[model samples]
Target: MIPIRDTAPCYSRPLATWGLIVVCVIIFVWLQFLPFEVSNPLIARFGMVPLRYSDPSWAEHVGLPFDGYLSFLTSLFLHGNWFHLIINMWFLWIFGDNIEDRMGHLSFLAFYLLCGLIATALQWYFDPRLEIPVVGASGPIAGVLAAYFFLYPLERVVLWVPPIVVHVPAIAFLGLWVIIQLYEATTSILFEGGVAKMAWWAHLGGFIAGFLLYRLFLKKPPDGIKMEDSSSFKI
Candidate 1:
């Protein structure tokens, strides 16, 4: 299902979220301008590579700079193509504003990076031996989705289910997402040699990290912002 929008309202503009999307877009545009020879090397150097750490010899082959640690952050801004960039940025656009409203701007940005780091770490943990470089904002965006899932469990979301648009409870929509991630993650580990085309574990990890970190990072809403429930949320 593709979410069109959410019913929950946001009083403050999500500046950080917008900035992130802009940065990602600019980077993608620059990437588009680069020839394949340079673009391929850029992705190799910046995208997270588990093999850089797990098998030290891998670095000799790809030459991951800054010892490959900074790739965790750089990878968040890189995307392989227009479709990959659009899907990730679209997700951030949908869920990020409400999450930004809930946590204040700077805090939300930190929360985003932390979740991305955690997502990268988890992907490495699950596929340490795999050599592919994982790239995208899906990790941080997953964090935003998890925060929204908790912040407005009952809020309705409009989604496209092929031929129809459906309004579903936030809980149902996000719950189904987590379920799909879990199923995909498990099956990937079991049958795909622990490496899927997309970083499924990173998506799952980002959600889990967001679930655990949102409360820690949460702050008072802006003067005009009002929270739903402000008391109870369901699973």
Candidate 2:
């Protein structure tokens, strides 16, 4: 199912969310200008390699001495293709504004990076020997979805079911989304090459991190609704 928009209302403008979208777009555009084929050594330099701690030759040539840790954050801004970049950024634009409003600017930014890092770590943990580069904002955006689920369970999300349509609660939609990820994750473990490209574990890890960390960073409504009780407020 594709999400069109959410019905939740925000009291504050999401400037930070727009800024993040712009940054991601610019980085993706820059990456497009570079050679992206697997044969190109440049891919290894900018991409996140799960097992290796050493810096790629391109990074060293460019005067970046750090290993893939920095790439964990940087890789989020890169994409393998137009479809990859569009889908990831689309979700980010859809859900990020509400999350930014709830967590404020700086806090949301830190939370986003932290979620991405944890998501990368989770993927690394599962596929330590895999050398394929994982890139995209889906993992961090999954984190935002988790926080949104927790903060606004009753909020309505308009979903486009191909040619059909349905309105579902954000909690239900995101819940099913996570379930799909879990199914893929488990199937991938049970059947070799069940899913070739997706990082299901990263989504799981980001969701868990967001669900937990949201408690500490979530802003209380100006009306003094308890965080736990704020779900009762409907749009």
Candidate 3:
């Protein structure tokens, strides 16, 4: 199911979320305009390649840096295609504002990067020798969804289920999403033998991080403001 929007409220501006979207869009567009020869190498250099860190000799043989920990954060701004970028950004747009509102700007940004780092780390843990470059914001965005799942359990999300739109409770929608990710991650590891296809493990890890760590980043709501307000702050 494709999510259209959520019914959660946000009183504060989501500047950090907007900034992240803009940065990702700009980088993606710039990569699209570059020659394939240049762009492909650039992506390989910046994208997270687990093997680069797992096998030092092989990484040096291919001229990759000695340390690639930066890619754990860089990969969040890089996407493989327009569809990949759109879906991630859309999900961020839908759920991110509320998260940012609750956490404040700087904390949200740090939380996002931390989640992305953990997501990629978990993916690397599962397939340390995989050579493919993992690039996308889905991991971090999954973290945002997790925060929304907890913060807005009583809220509803609007989804496009092909013929018509339907409103689903936040708990049900996000719970189903987590189940799908787990199923896909498990089947991919069992059948495909690795995560070279998609980083479902990263999504699961990010969701786990958000589920467990969101409270640490959250700030107190303004005086007299309750977090359960259902009136969303539109961008």
> Which residues of candidate 2, in runs, are more than 4 Å off?
35-40, 54-68, 193-195, 220-229
- Candidate with maximal TM-score: 3
* Lowest-sum lDDT 10-residue window in model 2: 51-60
lDDT of 1 by residue, 1-235 (tens): 7999988878899999999999999999998899999998888888988888787766776676446398989999999789999999998998899888878899999999999999989999988877778999988899999998888888888999999999998889999988988998899877854447788899999999999999888886569976455226432
Candidates ranked by TM-score, best first? 3, 1, 2
lDDT computed for candidate 1: 0.88
If the candidates were sorted by their lDDT against the true structure, best first, what order would they fall in? 3, 1, 2
Candidate 1 deviation (Cα RMSD): 2.7
Root-mean-square deviation per candidate: 2.7, 3.5, 3.2
Compared with the true structure, all predictions reach lDDT values of 0.88, 0.78, 0.88
TM-scores for candidates 1 onward, in order: 0.92, 0.87, 0.92
* lDDT of candidate 3 over 23-138, digit per residue (tens): 99999999999999999988888899989999989988997876538888898899999999999999999999999998999999999989999999999898788787899998
Candidate with maximal lDDT? 3
Report the Cα lDDT for residue 119, model 2. 86
